[model samples]
Target chain A: MYKIFLTFILSILLLPYSSTFAVEVDMLIPPSDFQAFDTPNDDGKSVTLRWPSSPSESTEAEYVVYASLRKNGPFTTEVLRINSKTMYEEGSDSNFHYVEIKPGKFFNKDSDVTGGRSSYFFRLVMMSNSENVTVNEIASATPKGNWFNWKKLNNFIILIAFSTLVLWFIEHAKKNPNLYLRKISGLDAIDDALGRATEMGKPVLYVHGLNGMGSISTIAAVNILGRIAIRVAEYDTTLKVSNIDPIVLSVSQEVVKESYLEAGRPDAYVEDNVFMAASEQFPYVAAVSGIMIREKTAANFFMGYFYAESLILAETGASTGAIQIAATDSYTQLPFFITTCDYTLIGEELYAASAYLSREPLLLGSLRAQDIAKGIIITALVVGAALATIGIGFISFIFKAS
Target chain B: MNFFKRTIPLIIAFIMGIMMAFQYYVPHEASQSLLKVVTRWGITIAGFAVFIGAYSLFHLHWNKIKRKVPGWGYSTFVFFGAGITIIFGLYNGGEFFLHDKQEGTMFDWMYFNVQVPAGATMFSILAFFMASAAYRTFRARTSEATILLIAAVIVMLGRVPVGALIWEFLPPIADWIMSVPNMAAKRGILIGVSIGAIATSLRIIFGIERAYLGGGD
Candidate 1:
């Protein structure tokens, strides 16, 4: 009796820490038709989906559907809350449950299918009462694919036009062999910011964004960091390159150290200057914000991908009156940076800045090619608009004519 | 030597880039196998790089602790956190439930419960700061500022129940502002941004941008 009492007390104490018993329930929606609608509405392929409603469906809760591109994917994750259209009748035995699968945007003009032409694994899960749990999943579903992306006609034309412009520019560059100059305000400010730091006898801080080395934007940031490090080495001024991503941090350390070595200032390279502040996002932001305030960093160089923290960093820099030079490929935060920073590189301009500053032949040539692509795109747009106004099928004619 | 240094990575990049590009259009089993091999090698190389990062981290913090730096105590905390997690992870070798699950381990506990919450706390604090900053910085200083301030106010008001009660037209106004004017501006910006990205990619692919390859004289 004493042993039993002790066991009961121990179990009660462990109850909160112990994992909750997961209730498994299977939820099904009715059979739906997957149709192809290129020429017209036609029967094509089929897909079946089964989801488990919440462990308790009759209770006050709803479910959302998620589909992944593959068996294990960067899942087709949507944050939209969708309620269960069909619920099990507690007292009735019904095998056939009618489900109204809403027409997704991927479908062209009231087509009864979702977008993309890949096998997707779908799961139905509930999100309510501070608990999110997956209820049921269909192992596979293939959305019908139509070859012609009619909806993306605008994008297709733009691509073709841009490719043409880029090719044209490449050819023009090859023939002329002349240096093409493009304005980059951020590149111009690099020297000014560095000079300010040099005069003030204060350090410059460089953040290589919040992405891993695998990201293209991080590569751009690292490239820019190398340039700044070289300048720092030459000036014999301090340059602290803080990184959030571990892999990028390693690469950045190498890049900065190499830059210093090349600048004939191998002794000036401090290991602590190139530090990795955690892999997490906002923590890195806090660390950076703290560093900016603590160091009284005269210049803040922000280059790469940034999200909500972009403005926070920029605003803090503004507060400090640092010559903030920010370049990012992110469109969302570009406006904020522009409003706050002294020099802001918009989108591809970040990439262009590196090329303009470095002027490597490959970079120049590619820039030239890309320009040609853009010109071609503009020409196509002009031609397409004109043809539409005149009621002629100019784009189709061009495709067929080619 | 110059030829080798410049052309080698460029050649490799081009070949890899082109191969990957073509593989997307091709539907061959051999191509698929090649892609799989490339992906596997990429992942392996990435894993090795991660190992290098871990080593660097160890070296940096170990030196700090040895030198008795101000934050040396934190270094000890990190070492213990990392060591205990690794020790427990390898000891049970998946036999124990605690060791079996990745999240069940101590590292995950520190990561999810402690580190993640600390990070989230920092992130959520931004919401309050944004409101304050918006009010201060977005005062009608100019035409653009006035327009921005008005739009922001409308959007903020439209998102709440009180705004709908005060003005029924506010919701539709907010929707129109977001979907039409905002969307148009966003689309324009997106297109412009994509153009820039493509240009940059072409430069890297062709080997014009060697600054990323680590700049030297």
Candidate 2:
């Protein structure tokens, strides 16, 4: 009986020591396959470190990543807790990857690393039960500037292909000089609108939209204005252009003046007719609305980028019983313009209108090229979809946009 | 004279356009810094353009008042509003232009109370206009018109809680139309617009489209 009691006491004394041994064993199992590489497609300021989780990884195990300029000693450590649910997984294997940007500042704020490029060494330590074990081999990476980013090589390829097609078509059209373009109804109605205004003896109002000179739609609007101004000059009718941007107003004045000169009616051109109304949104709409009411404009042209003011301007013009023709690239406001305006140029039609009206070889050729590009895109999309459906997704990957 | 007038401008534009386009592909720090510098220059130029616009406005209203044009009284109000706004903006209620506009300042007060309300009023008026336009255009006179009308009704009803109460399937059908047909059309337009925009940009960069340069010359 005394021997049995002594044995039980001895076992209890060794119990704590056995638990400590198990924890030490767990901590000794370090992470494996540690590697580091410079991150691509960025200014040479970041390096990525990756390592497989410790073979004895458990729910309680956490990772601490350390970095050092020199391969030996004085490492700054960053504790990283891996959430089991959110950590990335590849098949049955999971790896811990961390991107260290400007590693000197990131690992240690006091470390001065502003001089030039320097190599960085990384070590990952796995910790559990208040015990830690670091990987044996240190991984190193040096961030260097790359002249070209291979990741965006696909984007460059598409751009080059599209640009080549456009240029080739332009050159071809220049040689041929005979290309057919479909008639757009919105553009066709411009003459009729201007004619109606001339016959009615009422002034025609042309609004170059609320957008400034930077917008593509606004540029298109100005182009169309040039053509319309020439037509107005020919018809000997009054043309009033209301502008919201001062720069656009000045440009419009020059365009209109030039058009008048082209039509040999420079004397008939009124400088003040092409005037800046207001710059603010609602205020500009209000001014244009007042003009429509007061002038009783026979024909109204709303072209370029419009916002909430689209409906306001269109409604006011509609109330005047004017023949309203609108064109915009703004899809959100298309419904409003279609509802209010007599003729509305939808999307690409607005862009094509200037070319269609001018019949300039350059513009026409570019337009044709765009149509071809669209065709190619459609074909690729259909083929890619079919291939993807049949489990051949490599074609889709080839056409993937950045 | 012609060289200075046209050639120089076109050459400048070409160089700038090429540089700007190529800058996008470069990920170097120097390239990014250059882009920032160019953007700052653009902003400065835009500031000058704003001043020119303000001058144009002043000239326009001055002419209106000078001629006693039919609505000369309204022109006076425009000048008054502009003058008051300019004074408040420049003064910034004692902080001047050195510090940002603060709360309780005259500029902030006018902006929040007068400008905000007026802008909101103008925007709200669109609801009535939209209803009127819808009434005229949504008539079921043709097959296409009937389809449009039905779609419109479905979309309008689906947005409200009463729609779900009336028909359990309304919301899902509305979501389907919006997600499928509406999205497809919008994407089509976007693609077309993007292609067109690229074409236009190329045309401008190559100096092929010069109507923007002014018509005759």
Strongest candidate by DockQ: 2
Error of 1 at B13 (Å): 1.0
**lDDT of each residue in B1-217, candidate 2, tens digit only:** 6577457867887888778777777777777788999989878878887877777777878998999999989999888998999899989889898888767889889989999999899989988998998998899899988999999899878889988999989898899889999998898898898888878777777877767665633
Interface CA root-mean-square deviation for model 1: 4.7
Model 1 agreement with the true structure over A107-131: per-residue lDDT tens digits: 3333332453444455555655555
lDDT tens per residue, model 2, A1-402: 999999999999999988776755544577667788887776676776666655566666666667787788567655244532225434544565444456645555335343556777777777776777777888888776665667678777887888888888888889877788877889999999999999999999998777888788888888889888989999999999988887898889888998898899999998888988888899999999999999899999999989999998999999999999999999999999998999999888878877788887767898899999999988887898898899989976676665
For TM-score, the strongest prediction is: 2
Lowest lDDT block of 10, candidate 2 chain A: A79-88
Query: How would you class the docking of model 2?
Result: medium
Model 1 spans > 4 angstroms off: A1-182, A359-372, A375-402, B1-6, B68-73, B88-99, B102-108
